[model samples]
Target chain A: MHVTEDDLLKFALETCDDAEAQAIGEHVAACDECRERLALLRRDIAIIAGVQPEAERIPLPFRSYRPSVWRAAMRMAAVLLVGFVGGLAVSRWVCRCPVTVVPQYGASAARAIAASPQAVTPAPPVDLAATSQ
Target chain B: MVYPKGTYEVSDDWRDLDQARHGDEAAWRRLMERHLSRLVALALMMTGSPEFAQDAAQEAFVRLLKANPAPEQGTLRGYLTTIVYHLALKENRRSARQQNVENSSLEDDSPSALESMVRSEREWLVVGAIRALDDAQRTALVLRFYGEHTYEEIAALTGVPLGTVKSRLFYAVKQCREWLKEKGVFKECM
Candidate 1:
C-alpha cells in the first residue's frame, strides 16, 4: 500500500508496465504522500523534458550541389585525354623517314665513268700527232 | 492497442536510398527529404552547432549517396547515422581544439560575458555528470539519448560487448539520477 521513491521514479519514466504499473497507479490514487511524490517526479521529468536544447533548425536537405570544381576537373581530364591521344597520333604520323630515288646508269657508261675517275679531260691533240710522226 | 496507421511506414525510403546510390537524382532528393530532419536533429544534439550539424548531416547523406549500395546489411538511416556520428565527432574535436586555443588566448582576462550563465550552469552539471561516467557509459548515453540510437544499434555501432552496453546504459542512467539529485533537481522527488 506504500509506493517508494524508486517505484515512483520508475513509473514516471514509464519503465514499469502491466501489473506493476497498475499497482503503482492504485497506490498513487489512494495515498496523499505518494501523490505528492508523484507530483515531484512529474515535475522533475517535465524539467528534464523542458531543457529545450535550442530548436535544432532542421538543416535544409543538402541541395545536390554540383560543385563547379568537379565540372572543371572533369573538363581538365577530358582535355588531357584528348591531348594525349592527339599527341600519340601526331607522333605516329610525323616521325617517318623520307624515301629518296637513285638514278640508274647503263653498264658501259658506268664502266667508262669508273675508268675515267681521276680528272679526265680531252687529251691534248698533239699527243696523237706526235705519236704518228 | 493498435498503433496509428502510417505511424510505422516500412520506411520504403530505403528503396529511394538504393536508387540514389545507383545514381538516380530524383531518388536522391526523396531520400534527403525523408531523413534530413532527423539527421539534423541528431547532429545538432551531438555537435551543438546548427552550421556544423547541417554540414555533418549533409556530408553523411552525400556519403550515403556515393557509397556502394549494401541493402542487405541494414537500413539507409542506420548507415547515415553512423556516418554522421563519425563526422560530427571529427568536427567536435576540431572545434574543441579551436575553442581551447581561443579560451587560452583569453585566459588572463575576465570570464566570457556573452556565455548564457543559466544555460551554461545546467549544461555544466549535465556535462560534469557525463564526464564522471566511464567511457562506455558516456558513449552509450551520448549515442542513445543524444543520437537517438537503439540499444542493439548502439552495441553494433560501437562494436562493444552487448552486455557491456546494457550495463553501461544502466549505470549511466543511475549516475544521471544521482547527479540530478545532488543538484537538487530530484531532491524533492526523493
Candidate 2:
C-alpha cells in the first residue's frame, strides 16, 4: 500500500521509530509517486524555512548590560546572598561557639571581686577536705 | 531520502557557544552572527512585532551568555529559540497591557518593520499564509520548519504531548499547503 501524507510527514521529520523508518524507507525507494511527493514536501518546508529577512550584525557581549542580562545577574546575586545567610545560620546551629552571651571569670576571683560594683569583700574558696576531716 | 540535517550549518555553534559561555567575545559574536537572524524571525513569528522581535532575540543571547542554561534534550539552537519564544510571549503580553492602558495603534515604527513592509511579494505572501493559521498551529509550524526542530523539540518547547504536536503539524502543513495551492504560488515557486 502507498504511504499516507502522515507517514510521509513523519518520514520528512525523521520522527518515525527505527522499524517504521525502515518500512517507509523501503516503500519510498521503490515508489516513484511517493518519492516525488516527498520531494514536494521538502520544497514546501524549504519555502517555509527560507523566508528569513536579512539583518545587520548584532553587537554581542559589548552591550551585555541589557535588561535580560543584568536581570539574570541580579537574580544570581540574590540567590548567593540568600545562600550565604542560610549557610551562616546553619553552621551556627550545627557547630559549638567558643564565646557565650554571659561572661565567666576563671581563677581571678580577686579581679572579679574588684570588678563587681556590688562586691563588699572577696569570698574565699571552701576547703572541702578539711571540712570533711 | 538523505535529508539535510539542519537548515543552518550549525556545527561550530556548539564549540563557539561553549567559548562564549566563558567570556569569549569573538566567539560570542560568531554565535550571534550565525543565529541571531533566525532567532529574530522566531520572535517575529511569536510576537508579530518587529521591535519586540529584535529585543527578544537580543534577550535570548543575553540569557545564553549570562544564564548558560544548557538544554537537557535539544540542541543549543533549540534552546536559543525557546528563550526567544518565551521572551517574545512575555513582551507581547506587556505590549498588550500597555496598549490596553494607552489605547495606541499597533503600528510598529521600527526600521525593521518598515523593511518588512517592503519585502518581496513572495515573502509577503508566505508571511500572510503563515499568519492565517491559528496561534498554536502557527507556532508549531514556525518551530518545525523555520527552527528546523524535531517533533520532540517542538513538543518540549510547546509543552504539549507528542500526539498533539503531530496533529498540530499535520493541520498546519495542510493549511499552508492549501493556501499555497489556492494562491497558485506553489507551482510557480517550484
* Top candidate, metric lDDT: 2
* Interface CA RMSD, all predictions: 7.2, 4.5
RMSD of 2: 10.8
Relative to the unseen true structure, what is the C-alpha lDDT of residue A68 in candidate 2, on a scale of 0 to 100? 55
lDDT for B93 in candidate 1 is 80
Query: In DockQ terms, which candidate is top?
Result: 2
- Predicted candidate 2 versus true structure: per-residue lDDT over B18-126, tens digit per residue: 7766567798888877777787767766666667777777877777767665555447887788787778667767774432212222243343573664256666556
For model 1, state the Cα shift of residue B69 in Å: 3.1
**What is model 2's DockQ versus the real complex?**
0.17
The per-prediction CA RMSD against the true structure, in angstroms, equals 13.1, 10.8
Query: Fraction of true inter-chain Cα contacts (below 8 Å) kept per model?
Result: 0.04, 0.26
Docking category for candidate 1?
Answer: incorrect
Extract clashing residue pairs from model 2: none
Which number leads on TM-score? 2
Question: lDDT value for candidate 2?
Answer: 0.69
Q: Isolated chain A: TM-score per model? A: 0.41, 0.43
Which stretches of candidate 2 lie above 4 Å from their native place?
A1-7, A14-22, A63-133, B1-11, B21-25, B70-74, B97-119, B188-190
